[model samples]
Structures are given as C-alpha cells and as structure tokens.
Target: MSKLDIKQLTKQIIDGVGGEENIVSAAHCSTRLRIVLKDDSLIETDIVAEIDGVKGSFNNGGQFQIILGTGLVNQVYQEFLVQTDLSEVGKEELKEIASSKLNIAQRILKALADVFVPILPALVASGLLMGLNNLLTAEGLFVSGETVIGAYPQFADLAEMINIFANTAFVFLPILIGFYAAKIFGGTPVLGAVIGAIMIHPDLLNGYSYGQAVLDNTVPVWNVFGFEIAKVGYQGTVLPVIGAAFVLAKTEKVLRKFIPMMLDNIITPLLAVLFTASFTFIAIGPVMRVVGDWMTNGVMWLFFELGPIGGAIYGVVYPLLVITGMHHSLVTSEMQILANIETLGGSPTFAVVAASNVAQGAAALAVFYLFKKDVKMKAIASAAGISALLGITEPAVFGVNLKLKYPFVAALIGSAAGAAYATWREVLSVSQGPAGLPGVIVIRPQSMVQYMVALGIAFVVTFVVTILFAKMSQGKSKLN
Candidate 1:
C-alpha cells in the first residue's frame, strides 16, 4: 500500500482495536501483528476483519493477533506503532510486556524459541549437508550395493570432508547454544562462547564417550581442592549450556551493579566468567545434564517405544500446539533427538512433523479450490498452502483453516493417520530440517521413500476430507 493508504489503515486498526488505550503492547512476527490487550471483550474483531490488509484475526495465548500475511505485516505493524505512540517500545521491552501474561511453561518455551530462531539457518544448512553426506556414505542404495565412496575411490577424501563439515554443527552445538542462549538471557555473547568452549574443551573427557568410559572404568575426574569433580565435556548437550548461560548473564549483571566503575571493567567480566564456570562445572552442568537426559528419554520412548499410538496422539496435538505458539519450543528437543541419533536410531519426531505439516498444507490447498470465487481468500489460501508445504504453517492454520473451521479438523485427522504410518514404518531423519516436502532431504536414505508415502497420505487424506466437509456443510446453502 502507499504511504497515505497505510496511514489510513493504521488509523482504522487503532480505532477497530478499541483505540490505543485498550492495547497493552503490540508486536509482529513473520505474518501476524500480535497485541496484548487489557480487555479482550473490548476487541472489535469484526471491525478488524473488515479492515483492509487484514487476512484474518484471532486471540491465542494472551495475544490478540491479526494475520496480515507476509511482506505486509511489518508495514502495518510499523504504522500501527506510530499511530499508537508506541514507536519507542523496543524488542526487549515489548517482549517484557508481552510475556507478563504468559505462564511459566509458556515463558520457558518462548525463551527457547528466542535463542534458537537466530541460529536456525545454521542448523538447517548443516542438516542439508548432513543428508547429502549420509547418501554418499550409506551402503546398498546406489552403485552396485556398495557406498558411493566405495564405488568411486577417487572421491573418498571428498566424502570424508563432507562428513566433517556436516557434523560440525552437532559436535559443537553447545557453543552455538551458549552464544545464543546468553544473548537471550542477557549475557555477553562472546563470553557465552568461551564458557561453551570450556564445556567441550580437549582437556575434558568427551561427554559422548563418558557412557563408554564408565563401562570401561576409566571415567576421568579432577581433584578440585579435595572435591572429586568429573572432567566431562558436554559435547552435544542443550540444557547445560542454556542453564550455564542464564547463570552467567545473571551473575555478570549483578557484578556490574556492585563493582566500582574503574575496576569493574576488568574485574567484573573476569569474576563473572570464573565464578559462572566454576559453579557450572561443579553443579549446574551435571544436574541439568541429568534433567536433559530424562526429557530426551521420555520423548524417545514415546515415539520409538509406544509406536503408532504415540505418533498418532502427537500428530493430533501438534496443530493445537502450533495454535498456542508452543511448537516453536520443540527446536531444542529436536536438537537433543539429533544429538542422540545413533542411540535413538534416528529422529522420528521430524518425520511426524513432516506428516502434520503436509496435512495442514493440503487442507489449505483444498480451501483455495473451495473458495475459488473469493479472490482475497483464494490468494491467502494459495500462498498459505504453498508456504505450509514448504514447512511454515502458521499462515495456513490461522488464515485458511481455522477461519473456516472444518479444514482444521480435516488436517488433524489426516495428520494423525499419516503420523501413525510414519511410526509404524519407523521412518527416521538423519538430520533436522523443514517439516514438509523439503524435509525429505534430511530423512535417512532407507526411510526416504516411506517418508514420502507418509506425507502423500497426509496430503490425500486432508485434501479429500476438507472438500467433503465443505460440500456437506449445506445442501443448497454455501459455506461461510
């Protein structure tokens, strides 16, 4: 929209949402303008729906949201802020306001999302490279039942290098986590990296090999002034680094407050890192490690042990979690699953996610056909469908499915059926990636075909069911 048009729309939005007074805070994510309101009852959602540029709107997890779709939400959000005199509200302050209403669980999840979102590109790139490396190293797929490297001896060095490059992210995951987690928890990013490095330093016994070392009766420990503390490195752990960073950030902030300005510069950082490191190595790291292990084991048991039933249940609830915005929190769990890939066999959670994503996309695609005459809706559904198929589903869910109601239910049924098949066949991923068609790049070579079939089931089931539901809604009357 033009400058004047945006300004006009912004004014209309301000008026529609009970003016600036009703809004506690406002922010925007990929495609939605999210606002926390003092009174939800005062929200003029009908008026919001009538506003130009608003594709849809809803209230979820204390945030009243208006779906503006991609490429435009930011524009509207910026203008909304100017009109509401909230131009000075920065990201951190806005987050503080937005998080005030969230429960403990929600806040924790949101923190994970904040830390992981910035580093997602790194994870995605590494996952894709890992998948390529897997195909190159795996046997019985291409070239006379031997691995690609075996068939072509000339490429052996190249294959090894690819493997190294692919595994780098997972091996040094704590460092990345520490840096981002520190940023999230309000600590120095570089200091976080130093602490992260300390956890995986060569002087320490590798955490990955600690289990084996225990079996061999060779677990190493440091005599810390009479205390026997394990000198174990947290190679691929998530929670330990996160906890350590939180402590580091809080400790550094406290030191900065009490220390004199002259000596504070040198002493504060040094003491903060030293104290945080000592405490982490002594307590936080080990304790959090056990907690992390339990959480991983529980999820592993559900997907790998309970089989199809577990997968079906998770599939049904995945969309609900998305609605509540808690699904973003799963990034950390996905990391843990990938870290233990050798023991867990592979990552089934990713495969199930792929099924759920495909079903949502397929359902939205059906809506595009169902509302062919409504140009605005058709556009939203078309774009949302494609985006969901590419592993982003918020637009599809909020803009297309929930608006009509039946499409959401269709997606759930389809997702459940597809996820069951994935679990039954034990489909697995070699690395983490997108949750739809692109995710196939990361699936284990042996499970690739089966993974595709699972998504196909989701697409077909959701598409067919959405159509049937729309048609059955009324004999002579049209669906809203």
Candidate 2:
C-alpha cells in the first residue's frame, strides 16, 4: 500500500461525505471513522467508497461509518479535525452528539457499555487467572502422572495460595461493579464502594451460599421498620449493585437541591448514604435479586430444556448483540453461570460466544483474501481478522464484515452451526478467558477437543460461505 498522506485523504473524505457542514459529529474506533451526519442523503456513498485508502462504508446505529486501517484512521481523524470545524471539539462532545441521535433502547445499551468497558480489563485478568489455575490443576496437564496439586498432597497448600489470588476478584465483584456503576451514574465512587462493603460485611451471610439456606428455610433477615431485609451479601451479584449506585446518585442530587447550601458539606453525603443504603436494603436490593435470578434461570432453562437448539439461537444473536453494544448487559448472566458451574456442570455460554468470535474473524479473513489486489484493504482486513481471533471483534465486525453486509450474515450462520455442535457435545468452559482462539485456556481438560472442533467448524464454514457470497456480489456489481 502507498503511504497515507493524511491531509489529502482527510480532504477527500470530508468532500466526499458532503463537507464539514454535513457532519453532526465524528469519532473513530479502532479501524473505522464513525460520523453522525446531519442529513444522510447528502452523503455520496459511491464517491466515499472510491476515496483513496477507504476500504468500505456503511450506516449503523445512526452513524455513517467508513472503514480505514487502525493507525491510518487515527491520523486521518486528526487531520480531518484540523481541516474542518471539528478541531475545537473534544471526542466526548462528538460522542454526545452521536448519542443524542440514538433511540431509547440504543441509549441504554450505550450506557451499559460505558459502565462495563472501563472495568473489563480487571475482570479479564481475574478470569484468565482462574482459567490458569484450572489448567494447572487439571489431571495430567502439569503433572507427571496426575494433577499437579491433587497427587502431591504436599503441594496442596501452595495451590491454595494461588487460588486465593484467583478468587479475590470474583469474591468481591460487587464492590468493583459498584465503584464503576456509581462513577457512570454521576455518584461518588467511594460512597458506592462503601455500600458494596456494607453488603458483604463479615457478619452478613455470603450471597454465593444463600441458595442452600433458602432451600432449607434457614436464611437470616434483619427486621427494620416492620420490613424483613435479607442479610445475604451481594458478592457475585451485578444488577443490585448497579441499581443501588443509580438510586444513590439520583438521591444525592435530589438531596443537594433541597438541603441548604450552608449545611451541604455536612448533611448531603451522610443523608445520601443513610437514605440510599436503607432504601436499597429495604426495596431495591430484593427487587433486583429477583430480576437477576429470573435472568439466570431463564438462560439455564434455555440451555437445559432445548439443548443444542438453544445454543444455536444464542450464537446467532450474540454477534448482533455485540454490534448494538447490548452484549455488556449479558455479563451478569455469564457471571451467574460461572458462579454455579458446579451445579450446571459448566456453562456452554462462554464456548458458544468464543465460537461466534471465531466465525466473525473467519468472515473478515475471507474478505481480506477477496480484496488481495487492494493492499490497503487487505492489510486492514487481515489485522482486523487477527484481532477478532484474539478475542476482540469490534474491528473485524465494524471495519470489515458489517461494511460488506453479506460477511456479517455469513458469520452469524457459521456461529449457529458451531454453537449447535458444541452444545450437542456438551463442551464446557470452567471460566471466561479473553475469548476466541485464546479461549482454549478456559476449557475443561476433557472438553478441550470438542471446543477446538467447534471453533474449527465456525472458521471453515464462515470462510467458504463469505468467499462465495463476495464473489457473487462482485459479478453483480460488474453487470450493473
């Protein structure tokens, strides 16, 4: 590919998309130049596609997006800003403009993404560590004849020590979720952290073990204001913490408005915490627990009742969820599955998701081979495909597959095929990993082969289907 002249490319992009006046806002993700247009009709789609260095273009979630390779997109975005009226605007301002154009459901999904993306790194690390611990303990993997820690009783203590590190994060997951949730909701993060601590105080019953107590009718409750408040901690819970943080933030704002400014410093936080915490314990916490349980049972029912068919449906829709940014909302369900792995004998959800990611990458790889003549396009597709294989799919989906609509559909079909086979084989993942090819790290020893087969099917099926469809489209375009 020729070296990108940022100035020239940026000018072509701006002029082809109807100049600066036509743009409401502009931003770039890993490999796409995302813009919100004031009037969609003003965009010259053919002209934009023909611009030098532009790979493909599409409209999604009210944004007019243009695919450009990762490094080049940022340089083009910077140059585009300088040459246009957007130079003075911050990225956040552009995001706000784009968000203002979304519908109610889309706005909620965006909010969930904002809350979860910041905390994903920590969860990702803890999850990988859990998988590593499982691998080390798996029979015959890291041992001469048997499991490393299981056969040598002397090494048990050392194994337990390592387990502590793996368990700490998930054991206190609510605290982490609360801190991030509060920040997202415009509340004091420290205060939300304190609420998380309160919920998990040593005196309270551990939430993870609460189900047995519930079955035995031995669960503890605190009586306050003639109401019985469950004393179960919110360790692995997600919905309650998020709901609490949101309520706390709104309550604080209301208190600030009514409370005298002179006494604000002393009274506001104290009352905010007291009232919010009380209300949460009394109402919100219990209500959210019911909702969380419903979602958990719903997924459990789907998998157990319908088996492979359920997995097929989940796989087909998951990529579409990722596209709309709604996948973050399902993290709570994933966590619940992980927490109850013993009862479920392992969740097929993670394996299905991993297969979907592989399918997406495979579809992008097919597009990469199709555009072999265009060096810039091939390079972008290859890099995006590799990123997807490594467990990141935004670049592959938005930058390649979705730009050429057929590839995205091909990926979904491939994902469904893989997921059904995986579920039929009952492939199990012990914990979440970075996903995609690296997801092998989380598969149970006995299920590893099945997982690999699922992934291979997803990749091969998507690649062949996408290549055939793209070739057909090429012929149609020539005829036109």
Candidate 3:
C-alpha cells in the first residue's frame, strides 16, 4: 500500500539476517528473495518479516526465502547487492552453494537437474506438439492414406509441415543437449554443436532403430586407431551426449592452457572437437549408454516389482525430491520409457509425477482458502496454486506449501494415494509435458480418463487433508 526506501529495506533485511557475514549466497526467483545463511539460529526472523514491503518469509531447500512480489523482490535484491559484496553471486553459484549442504545422493541428483533442467523447454515444446500430432492422426481422428494425395487430400502440405515442427526437436535432440551442456560446462557451444552433428552424420546408422541392424548382424562399425567403433547416431540419447560435452569442455580447457593466443581460433577448437569426438565415440558414448540402460532398468525393475506400492512411494518422494532439487534425475528413466515404449511399456512415472504435481497445487489452494485473513499469504497461495496446476510447482512448493510446513506433508499423503490408484489402472504418458491438469495432453489416449481420475483424487485428497491440518494448527504453524 505504500512505497518505501529500498536501501532502508535492504539494510533491515541484511542486518536482521546477521549481516553479510551470515549469508552464504543469495539468489532470487520470480517472487522470492532466496538466501543461504551460514547460521539459521542467528537470523532475526521477526525483524525481517516485519519489514515494510515484505510479504512473507520462510526457510526451505536450504534457503531462507523472503516472499516479496516479483518486481519488488528484484529491486530489493539489487539494492541488497549494492549494499554488500555479493554482487557477483549468480544463480548457478548460489545453487552450488545450496547443493553443497546436501548429501552425496542429493548432490548427484542436483547435478542431474542442472544438466536436464535447461533442456526441458525444448523437450516440453516438442513433446506437446508430437502428442497433438499423435492425437490428430489416431484411428478415429484421421483416416489412413495409402498415397501422398490420399493421406491429406485437403491439408497434405499443412500436415507435412506440422510433422516437421513436431519432429525437429527430437530429431536434433543431441545437438540441443550438446549446445546446452557445453554452455553449462563452460566450453565453446559451437564445438559441442559440431560434435553433436558428427554423432548424427548421414553416414551413421540411426541409433533409435539400430536394434534391427544389430539383430540382422548388419550394424556398421568403423576401424579407427586399431579400435572398432560403432557407427550409430545418438538421436534421443541423454547421458552419452552430456558425458561427451563434459569431456569436450575439459579437453578445450586443457588445450587453452597450451595453445598460444593467436593460434587458439584454429588449433583449440579443431583439436578439442577431434579428440573429444573420438574419445566419446570410442569410449564415453558406449560406456555411458550401458550405464544409462542399467539405471533405467534398475528403476523399472523396482516399479514393476513393487507395482502400485512403488508408484505410491515414487509419488510421495518426488515432491520432497523437488524441494531438494533431485527429482529431475529421474528424467533418464522417463527418456528410456519415451523412446522404448514397445519394450518397456509406457511411462508409469508420468502418472505418479502428475499426481504429485496436482497434489502440490491442491495443497497450495487449501492454504489460500484457509489463510483468507492473511491477505498477502492468500495472494501468494493463489498464484502458486495456479502455477502448480500449469506444471510449474516451484512457486507453490517454496512459496506456499513448504513454507506452511504441514501442507507439504498433507500433499505427500494425497500424492501417494493418487499414484497408487493410477499405477493400478496402468495409466501411462507417452511424452514429456507439464504435469497435473495439463498432463492430460501427453497421457496415452486410452488411459487419459484414468489419469484425470488420478489427478482429481490427488487434488481433492490434498485439499481436504490440508484444510484439516490448517484447522488443527490454529494458525500457529504458519511461517511469518
């Protein structure tokens, strides 16, 4: 309701948090000022929360978060930066600092997230279009055509064009992975792109359908430096490409050290690409792929052996994993399912993920309704709930449910129940997309209704349970 001095507000927040000495790192996302504190006990929570323009404050995921609205948060964060020496602290650095506090497993999971998260937008967009194409060309939707004209008598060209859009991302997925992975590893992105291009060159056999060639004993192999190398392209691969990128980055760094400044442009990139590509194909690609398959099968074995109970546990753990930034590690499993539906069956992981996502939104919605008197919190909850339903749960998880504590537990219970029901029904998703309400777009057509039922279960159960929790807590459990 009132404009206040940002400098004053920044000073208050820093001083309240025991000054810059107490803060390990600081970063901001959309609607919160996220800070990692060296000592939580030293934080003057009440003082910081009482600051004007501050909406709410809480700690989760190893970060002390202040819920300032988007525009205000950025401004305060900038002023806070100016007042302190944390100006150079970027999001990645802060993430690393936060992740350092986690155990080895969590650190590995976070590393997995770091690799996959940046690439998710490409995956989501392409997956959505592909799903729509499948739906449009389904048996009852479009008649099968024997010839080009017969296939699309009216919209043949349009259909062909749309198919290209749907297929491009997946077709060039390795290139995308290379570009992003190289950037993440601090290498020249163009070198990674070149390496990716080499992997999928026209001379190479298609990796996706190479099994038939293997069965027929016709798969191509190349003799290089007395080593036999597979000539299969990496189309939908995950680990091999990422591993290759890391290798390329390290190799380039080593090259940079010895190569003179003037000769760098020609020698550095050439040597880097040449060595890295050879090393990747000769060793890294084959080895990481086997490791990736092992990880995928391990997860699938647990899912099938445990059946519905496994799905329930997966659903419960996923949201908590999200808070710790570990759930994205499961992408390797989902990628396997997406690429090998015939062998692996469709993805049960999606059914559980959808359940978890909807439950998060439901929990946030309940908090919104229960905290009707706390206008700022109610506003935050409403925004977060909407975000979660759209398949982005960070706002809902960090800004609302986890902040409130009890609601997060209630959501976990609801998620487990809903996931068990979905697993029993054998609901499956064919591709990646936003989970929760939007998940219906990517689920198998035959199982779409069942998936919807699972979502409804998650939402209703979480909402009801959270309401009860809020009522019992009597407003005392809220974060200020």
Highest lDDT, which number? 1
lDDT of 2 at 332: 68
Model 1 vs. true fold: TM: 0.90
RMSD of each: 2.9, 3.3, 4.5
**Top-down lDDT ranking:** 1, 2, 3
Better of 2 and 3 by lDDT: 2
**249-276: candidate 1 lDDT, tens digit per residue:** 9998999999999998799889989998
| Candidate 2 residue spans exceeding 4 A from truth | 1-5, 39-46, 57-64, 88-93, 140-145, 339-347, 370-380, 430-432, 468-480
| Candidate 2: residue 9 Cα off by (Å) | 2.3
Higher-lDDT candidate of 1 and 2 = 1
TM-score of 2: 0.88
The TM-scores of all predictions, comma-separated, are 0.90, 0.88, 0.82
Which parts of model 1 have CA positions greater than 4 angstroms off?
A: 1-8, 24-31, 34-36, 59-63, 69-82, 88-97, 342-345, 372-375, 475-480
Q: Lowest summed-lDDT stretch of 10 residues in model 2?
A: 85-94
For each candidate, what is the lDDT? 0.85, 0.80, 0.79
Q: Please, what's the RMSD in Å of model 3?
A: 4.5
